[model samples]
Target: MNVLIAMDSFKGALSSERAGKALERGILRTSGHQTTVCSVADGGEGSVHALAACVKGEYKTWQCRDAFHQRITVRTLLFKEGESLCCAVEAADIFGLHNCEVSSATAATASTYGLGELLNQLHGHAIHKVLLFLGGTITTDGGLGVLQGLGIRLYDQMGNVLPDDCNPLFAFDHWDEEAFQTVRKKLGDMKLLVGCDVCAPLYGKEGCVLTYSAQKGANAMQMHKLEQQLHLLEQRSARNLMQEGCGAGGGCAAGLHILGAELTFGYELINRYVRLEQRLHTADLVITGEGQMNHQTLQGKLPIRIAQAAKKEGIPVLAVCGQREVDCIALTTYFQGIFTIQQGIYPLHEALAHTEEYLEETGYQLMRLITMTAGISHTVLKNQKVTIAEELCRKGKTI
Candidate 1:
């Protein structure tokens, strides 16, 4: 029996690789099932490193602006195969929240201008495809800054180029006539794919401005203004604004759609890019996890995707996380089990600091249950606390 260990980074805790190795350690200690470790990401943070490690892509750095237009150097990923060229650009690296405090100030000021600049550099790099990793960015500019970086002139009624700011996007009139016609062509048959996790559309109650801007630090007034501006732009743009994933990257994906890019779930694309299915199907069990398991994971997240793939092959999947916040009973139909690694009550900081220790303990505890399944026919409770108690009783260990 093969147990494939493909875990995502625990975020400020353990890396996917480290977490997988730790789980493998415990599994080997109890069950004799073969274990394999695969590092994974959902095209949010740590995507670059995960893809780089797997694909052996060349990393290039360029000086660009952060979310606040501060000068910063960002890395670009290039993966080539024969005549096929794919360049992966992580938007968060250019204009992510980590660059500044997540406050109303950052929300109003952060722009995607630097991402556009990065695209301009790649537009002429003999590239056949561009992969835009669209998560963890601190911009709500709706791709306005990106258009500017792509040389799409945003002009006022007087035909003067507007300033490079999200605020200026509200006043934006018609685009420069000629530049609009040729911008996609200028990209020279390159397919632009925006990889995202969310399916929120461009506007309305379920849209980017309404659902996500607050998380980016938009105050009430700012959300109202941003909503109005986004509504205005979406109306005049004459494109279908009700598309799903338009809300991704703070509506940057919507703007990218206007600029001729296709939208795809980030992990879905990464799975294909990494050829994950072939490895997944051969396994008897798949162990995958991320930092958190909640409503977010229910929405096409990495662990769910792994579970989906494993399910297709009639294999059971177990997801282990640093913490579990929601009742995952609904997830059990897809995943065999969902467990948290926390052994007992500890401060959040201490749990994070010693994530590996908890992970190893949890992994051992998990395999102990799997071992018991073969002999003792005790049912494992779906409730996390009950599961932990049962594991403790089975091992006769006090926490």
Candidate 2:
């Protein structure tokens, strides 16, 4: 049997490529089946590396700033799959909660300026296309910080430049138009695709600030402060923040939109590069997984999307996750089988630490079930053949 294994990262445990390999090892241990492993992510942290592994591309690192303006070197993927260079940038590399202690203060002050630095450096090298994976960001600066990195100067009516404060970003009455245009001009004809997993609007009671700011450390007051300002800024900017993905990366998607970037669902972009559809056609079974399997996975997570596609092709799909939160009945509609990496109750940290070991073990157990299933089918077929021959002998004797 041919099995296609596509998996996302387990977050703090296995990367997508590693997860795929672990699963592949389990399937190969007993089945001797043809297995194909593809690294996949839901357009979030580790996406750059995942897509890079999929395309056999080169990994490039950039010395840049984090959301806190600290020095750091992050990675990007360079895929020369076509005539131009395609670079994948994971937004979490600059503004992920894991990278810093995020609080309301951090939420109000964190900047995506590091993201801009990455883009500016790539533009300098005359790169062709850049895929900005806009997911799991802590900042809600509306991309002002991102633009600041690209040399866009925000100004007050009095002509003083705005500081790198999130609050003041709303107060700015104008920006240096020439500088803003220059970056866009320099990036002329270069397509910027912002890969976002969510379709949240930028400003509303249900918008990014109200929906996600609290998780990023915003308290009641900070939430109010951001809501009021985002409302005002949306009015002043005159750009549509009501579009799907506008709330991605804490308004970074909207900010990138201001920079002439097109918003595309993150997995869709990755799927294009991987050509996953064609591969699914020939596979007898498909195994897809992620860090978490929940209602959120329904919102365009790679594993769910893979399962959906596999179902269309009459291929059975199995899912293995680090944590399983989705209702089994609801999830089984999409996945024929679902497994979790956790063997027992453990502290979150301990579970995370043992994720890879658990995943390998889970893969092995699932494959054993497949082996049992095959054996049962063979036994049932043998029984049917014996019964048929016995009936035939009885009929001959009667004649």
Candidate 3:
């Protein structure tokens, strides 16, 4: 049987390729069943790496700031589609939440300036298109920092320029669009595609601030302030505040929209580049996973997306994760089986460090089950008169 091992990154532990390869090791240990390891992502933290792996692209690293204005090296994917040069950038890598501790202070200060700086460097690359994966960010400044980094000046009511390092969503009264327009003109015919999974609007009851800010470590007061600030920015810019996916990356999507970006589903955008569906067509069984399986998985996480595609093609999919936080019954609609790699309780750090070992063991065990089941089925088909228990004993196997 042809088995496809496609796993998303295990967060801070293993990357998509490394995790898939570890699982591949276990599967091969069980038997020499054909296995293919595919790299996958949901346009979030590890998306650039996944795309690079899929297309055999080269990496270009840029010196940029993190969400907290700390100097960091960010990697971007440089690949070609036909003759057109394309680039893939993951917002999380430059301005991701992982840059700092999740707290009200961090939530209130995070910015996307680093991402903008990276984009500024792309000016003379002659790139035909850019895929900006907008997820896993902590900034809620409505992309003000990004605009600032791109040379758009933000001013307060007093007409004084606001700093780009802090969240200026509230202090933002107006901006100089001349620099923004110049940056746009410099790109010429290059297409900017924003890959985001959420459909939350910019600022409303279900918007970025109220729905996601708390998780980013915003306290109630910070949340209230963020909401009001986002509302003010919305009214000031007169952009469509209720546009689908406007809330992604803490209103970063809406901010990019002002710069002529086309918002698309994160998973689908990556799928188009990776050709996951085309690969699925040839697989008999698919094994996919992520770091965690939770309610959010149903809302279009990478593994669920892979499972949905496999299901549509009548390919059974099994998932193995570091942990399972969602009900199995609900996930059963997409996945035939769900397995967890953790064998015993451990601290979060230890658990993360052992993810590779756990995944390999889980894969080996799962493949063993499949192999034994296939053997039993073959025996039953060959000898209709023999009972299953008798067949097992005859084969010198335990029932």
Best by TM-score: 3
lDDT of 1 by residue, 1-399 (tens): 577898987777776788888888888887556788887777777676667777857888888677787889988888886778988888888877653457788776778888888887777777888888787777887888888878788876687788876545556666775887688677647889888867678778877888878878889988888887788778767788678778788888988888889988888767765677888755666889988887657666688888887767666678899877766556666665678888779987788888887788888878777666433222322211133334445666432
Question: Which ten contiguous residues of candidate 1 have the minimum total lDDT?
Answer: 376-385
Per-model TM against the reference: 0.86, 0.84, 0.87
Tally clashes: model 3: 0
Best of the candidates, lDDT: 3
The C-alpha stretches of model 2 lying farther than 4 A from their native spots are 81-83, 155-160, 165-174, 326-332, 370-399
lDDT of 1 at 90: 82
Go through the candidates in order and give each one's C-alpha lDDT. 0.76, 0.76, 0.80
Pick the winner on lDDT between candidates 1 and 3. 3
Residue runs of model 3 more than 4 Å from their true location after superposition: 177-180, 185-188, 197-199, 204-206, 327-329, 371-399
TM-score of 2: 0.84
